[model samples]
Target: MKEVKIESVFQVYEGILELPEDLQELMQKAIEARQKAYAPYSKFYVGVALLLDNNEVVLGSNQENASYPSGLCAERTAIYYAGAQYPKAKILKMAITAASQLRTTLEPIPPCGACRQSISEYEIRQKSPIEMYFMGERGKVVRSYSLSNLLPLIFDKSQL
Candidate 1:
């Protein structure tokens, strides 16, 4: 048997202020969206901001429900809305952030597994990569050039 290895790489910024102007703007929008999150159960608010190929920005926040599995994550909500509203447009970038009543997580907030698969579908459909920016504690940010970096060997239609 042959053993194979995979590696993922990303950049970490000192803080949001150190990011580029556009990325900083996107992060700000994510923060604003977080304010609207309806997470009464977890009390952890998550927000996502997407930049479409048409230069339009779309925002989404986590929506929780009484049924745990019925709730939707901020990333999926934003991605679905973008897909429905701008079917022809490609998602170029996405910024994600989260806040908790307890304390600020001192690490980048990565998308859940289900969200990663959902995001991979769009990337495969658009035939391009979607840059991602994740927020961490003390304004720290993580930048990833593509979803593949986060979800490698992903299951897609190509496998079917």
Candidate 2:
């Protein structure tokens, strides 16, 4: 039997300025969206912004429900909205940010497992990678990585 290997790449940045201006704008929108999160339960508000190839920006905020499992993440919310509103457009990139008790947290906001999987679907559907960005309360724009990098060995329709 032969062993298969998969690898991914990510680059940490001092801030969004290190990247393209468009990416910087996306991150800013994500941070602004954080203010609208409805996360009373966890106090961990997350915001997501998707940049469509058509030059549209979609925003999402974590919505919590009385029943924990019923709630959806910001990433999915934004992705779903983008899919519904701009069905034919490709999602070029996404930026996510989080806050707590009126202040941003120190740690970079990472997408949940389910978010990663959901994002993987778009990557496969679009036949292109979706670049993702995240930041911490310290205003450090930690890193950027492709969805494939985060969800390697993903189970797509190919498995069905």
Candidate 3:
């Protein structure tokens, strides 16, 4: 029997100031999008912003529903919008931020498994890596990983 280990690779930036100009702008847009989040249930507002190759930025905020599952994450919302509006464009980067109702969640919020898969699909479709940046309400950038980092061993369309 052979034992194999999988490693996750990522880079951590000191803060938003260290990000590229366009990425910093996208991150700021994600923060601003938080205000529009409809999170009556979780009280956890999440915002996502995506940068497309055509120099277009798309923003999305979490929308909650009473039924729970019907609600969608900001990442998926923004990504889906990009797919519908800019099908041919490649996704370059994504920034995400989250806040809690009680207090600012100081911990960096990670995406749910489902959202990771959704983002992975787009990355595969575009045949390009999508850089993901995430931070908490206030802290150093918690995590920054490429699309390949989050969805290693992904089943691409070629699998079918």
Each model's lDDT comes to: 0.93, 0.84, 0.85
Model 3 residue 74 CA deviation in Å: 0.2
Q: Provide the lowest-lDDT 10-residue window in model 3.
A: 138-147
List per-candidate RMSD values in Å.
1.0, 1.9, 1.6
Residue pairs in collision within model 2: none
Ranking by TM-score: 1, 3, 2
Please state the error at residue 110 of candidate 3 in Å: 2.2
- Specify the highest-TM-score model's number: 1
Estimate the TM-score for candidate 1: 0.97
Native-vs-model 2 lDDT? 0.84
List, residue by residue over 6-106, the lDDT tens digit for candidate 1. Answer: 99999999889999999999999998999999999998999999999999999999999999789999999999999999999999999999888888776
Q: For candidate 1, give the lDDT of residue 48.
A: 92
Query: Higher-TM-score candidate among 1 and 2?
Result: 1
Clashing pairs in 1: none
Candidate 2 to truth, TM: 0.90
